[model samples]
Target: MGLLVVAALAGACGYTASARYQPSGATPSSGAAHDPTTDPASATAVALSVAAGAATETYRTDIGNATAAFVADIGTLQEAVDGGDIGAAKSDELAAQAQYDTFRQLEGGNAVNASTLDELATEVAPNGSFAGLHAVERDLWTSGNARADVAGLSVQAPVAQYLLSRDRLTPEAIGTTAVSELGWVVSTALPGREERFSHLDAVDIAAAVGAADQAFAAIEPVGRTVDPDLTTSVAQVFSSLEADVGSLGPPTQVPDAAIPTTLRLSVSQQVDATAAELAQLAARLAPLGTAGAPSS
Candidate 1:
C-alpha cells in the first residue's frame, strides 16, 4: 500500500459513533463561575466523556502492547518451526492467536482494509495469500506441513501505527460496541470458530469479555452518578457473566461440543441481561447532555 493508503487504514476499523449527545444549547448553560452542583446533568455528561476518554487511552495502550506481542510471537513461531522445534512452535502459535483475539474487535469496522490485514493474519482467503498466523497454525496442528514463510509476514507495524493516528471512540460508540461485542461472543465466538485449529475458544472469549468490561467501566462512574440503582444492576450482571466465563477453566484444545450445553445457555442468558441493562443505560444517558429537566 502507498503512504496515503496506509494512512487511511488508520480509520479502517470497525466502530461507529453510537453515543450521540444533543447540542450544547440543549443543556442549560452555566456561567464561567457556575458550580457543577447546580447543573447535575451537564456535569455528568462532561464526566462521562472524560471517563470514556481516559479509558480509550488505556485501551489504546493495551492494543499497542497486544499488537506488538502478536508480531513478536509470530516471529518466534517462525523461528521455532524453522529450527524444527515443533513443540515450541505450537505453544507460540497459541499465544499469538490469543494476542490477535485481544484486539480483534478493532477490525470490526474496517471493511475497506479489513480483508487486507485479515488475509495476512488469518486463513480466510482462498487465494495464496494466507501466509501468517492461521496458516502457521494449520501447519502446526492439522496440515503437518509446518512450512509457511512467516518471516516475511508483517501485520504489527501498520496496526500499531494506525492506532496512534485514530481518534478515541466516543462514549456512545463504546457503549454500543460493548453490547454488540458481548452478543457476538455469546452467539458466535463461543462455538469455537474463532480459534478453530488451536481450539483456544476460551482465550478469545476471555479477551473479548475483558475488553467489553473495560468499555463499560469507562462510562460506569457517570452511570452511577446518574442512576446508581441501574449502574449497580449492570455491575452485578457483568460480574455474573465474567464468573460464568471463568468457570470454563483454561483455554482448551478440544471441539466446541466439549463445552457443556448448560453452561452455554447460562452464558447466553447473562449476555442478554447485560445487553438489556447496558442499552437502557445508554438510552438514559443519551438525553442527559440535552434539554434540561424542570426544577423539582
Candidate 2:
C-alpha cells in the first residue's frame, strides 16, 4: 500500500469531467463527442461523473478536517512528551492516531508528493528518518517512553488541500482505487501489518472499509441507473463486509494475536467478496462512457 502514494498520481492528475470515454483501440467519431441527451451511455456517464465530482469535494473537506485535527493532536503530544508527562503524551498520541485513521486514505491517493505524507504519518521514511506517527507510537509503547523527534511532521494538511486542487474525481478512478484499497485491507491490514506498534490495526481497518464504502456510495446511484441488479448485489456485499468489520468491535489497543482467528478470517473473506462486487460495479460503469474499465 505504500506504493499507493505514487500510484494514485495517475488517477489524480489531468482529469476533467468533459473528457470523452473512448473504448480501447476505437477511434473517435468525426463529430463532437456524443451528446448526453441522446446517448444513454453518455447520459449515464455524465451523471456518474457529476456524482464523482461531488464526492471528491466531500472527501477533500473530510480529509482536510481530519488532517487539521491530527496536526493539532501531534503538537499537543509533542508538548506533553517534552514536558515529561508520559500519560499526557500517550493520550495525545492516541488522539492523533485516531484522527489520522479517519482520513489515512488521503495519504495514498491524493498526496501531491511521495514524501509529503510519508514525512508526516508513515511507518518508515524512505530517507531513513524515523519520525511521524509511527515513530511517536514506538516511543510511547517502548519501555523507555522517551520523547520522539516530532519536528516537521505536519505536511498532511497541504496534501489534503492538494485533493481540492486536483480534478481527477471520476467514477472510474474512485471505484478502481476503492477496490484496490479493500484488497489491501483484507490482505495486509487485518493480518496485523498496519499499526503494529500501537495495536490499532482495527481502527485502520475500519477506516479503510469506511473509505471504500464512501467510494461505492459515490458511484452506486449511477450504477443503479445503468444496471439495477448489479448495484443491488454490490450494496448487499458491502453490508455484509461492514457487518463483519463491525464484529471486530470498536477500536481498542489490543494485539493482533488477541483478536480471534475466526473473526479475522470472516472479515477477510467478506472483504474479498465486497471487492469483487465493487469491481463488477466498476466494470458496469466503464461502458457508460463515464468511467474507465478495470484492468482485468
Candidate 3:
C-alpha cells in the first residue's frame, strides 16, 4: 500500500501540461552571422542563449518529473484504498503531506523573476487574447514553486482519501479511472475557464477572485471526507482556490487595482484547471482495473 501511494505520487508529478509555444518562421540569428569570433556583444549573446536554452530544458524536465511523481502517488493511493489497507494509506497520506509542505515552502521562498515576467508580458501583448492568457499561464508555471506547489496540493489530498476508502473499489480499477478522469479535466474543464477569463475586465477579475476565495473557503469540509464528493462542488472549490492564489500580487509590482488583471485571470484559470484535474483523478478511482492487471 505504501508502495502504491508512492506510485500515485510519481504519476501526479509526471503529469505534463503541453507547452504553449509554436515554431515561428523567424529563427534566432546564429552568432556566426554576427562574428562571435570577434564581436563581444554577439559572443555574449550566443553564450546567454545557450545558457538560457539549457536552463529551459532542465526546468521542463524537472516539471515533467514532478508531474509524473504526483500522478504515481495518486495511483499508489488508489491501490491502497482498493486493497483496504487504511493504515498504509494513512502512512502514504503523511508522506504526501510532508511533500506538500515542502512544496509550499519552496514556492513561498522563491521570488518571481522580473525579466521572465517582462518577457511573458511582451509575448502576450501581441496576442491580447486567449493566446496571451496561455502565455502568462506558461510563464507562471515556469517559476519553480508556483507550478510544483499547486500540483503537489492538487494531487495529494484526494489520493489520501482514496487510500483511506480502499474497501470501496479494486486497486486497478481505481487507478485507471483516476488517470482517465484527470485527462478529461485537464483537456476540457480547465482550458474552458482559461478561455473565459481571458476576456475579463479589471472589475470582473476582482469579482472572480473574490468569488473563488469564497468558494475555496466553502470546501474546507470536503477535505475531511473519507468518501469525498468529486462532482461540481469539488471542481468549484478547486477553481476558487486556484483563482484566489493566482490573484495574489506579483513579487514586485506597484499597488494598483487594475494592474495585471488579465495576468491574474490567467493564473487563476491555470490553478483552477489544475485543481479540477486533481478532483477528476480522485473521482475516477472507481473504474480502474476490474480485470487482473495491477494499477498503472
Best by TM-score: 2
The segments of candidate 1 whose C-alpha lies over 4 angstroms from its true place after superposition are 1-49, 116-132, 145-149, 160-165, 253-255, 285-296
Estimate every model's Cα lDDT from 0 to 1: 0.61, 0.62, 0.33
- For TM-score, candidate 1 versus 2, the one ahead is 2
Query: Where does candidate 3 stray beyond 4 Å?
Result: 1-40, 98-296
Best by lDDT: 2
Q: Lowest-lDDT window of 10 residues in candidate 3?
A: 286-295
RMSD of each: 9.9, 8.8, 23.0
Give the clashing residue pairs of candidate 2, or none.
none
Ranking by TM-score: 2, 1, 3
136-173: candidate 3 lDDT, tens digit per residue: 23323343122332233344434432322222222222
How well does candidate 2 score on lDDT at residue 49?
47
Candidate 1 has which clashing residue pairs, if any? 12-110, 13-109, 13-110, 14-108, 14-109, 14-110, 19-172
Scored against the true structure, residue 211 in model 3 reaches a CA lDDT of 32
Model 1: worst 10 consecutive residues (lDDT sum):
287-296
How much is 71 displaced in model 1, in angstroms? 3.0
* lDDT score for residue 47 of model 1: 55
Better of 2 and 3 by TM-score: 2
Model 2 Cα shift for residue 94 (angstroms): 4.2
How do these models rank on lDDT, best leading? 2, 1, 3
Off by more than 4 A, model 2: 1-49, 79-88, 91-95, 98-106, 109-127, 143-148, 155-160, 163-167, 287-296
lDDT of 3 at 119: 22
Global lDDT for candidate 1? Answer: 0.61
Candidate 2 global lDDT: 0.62
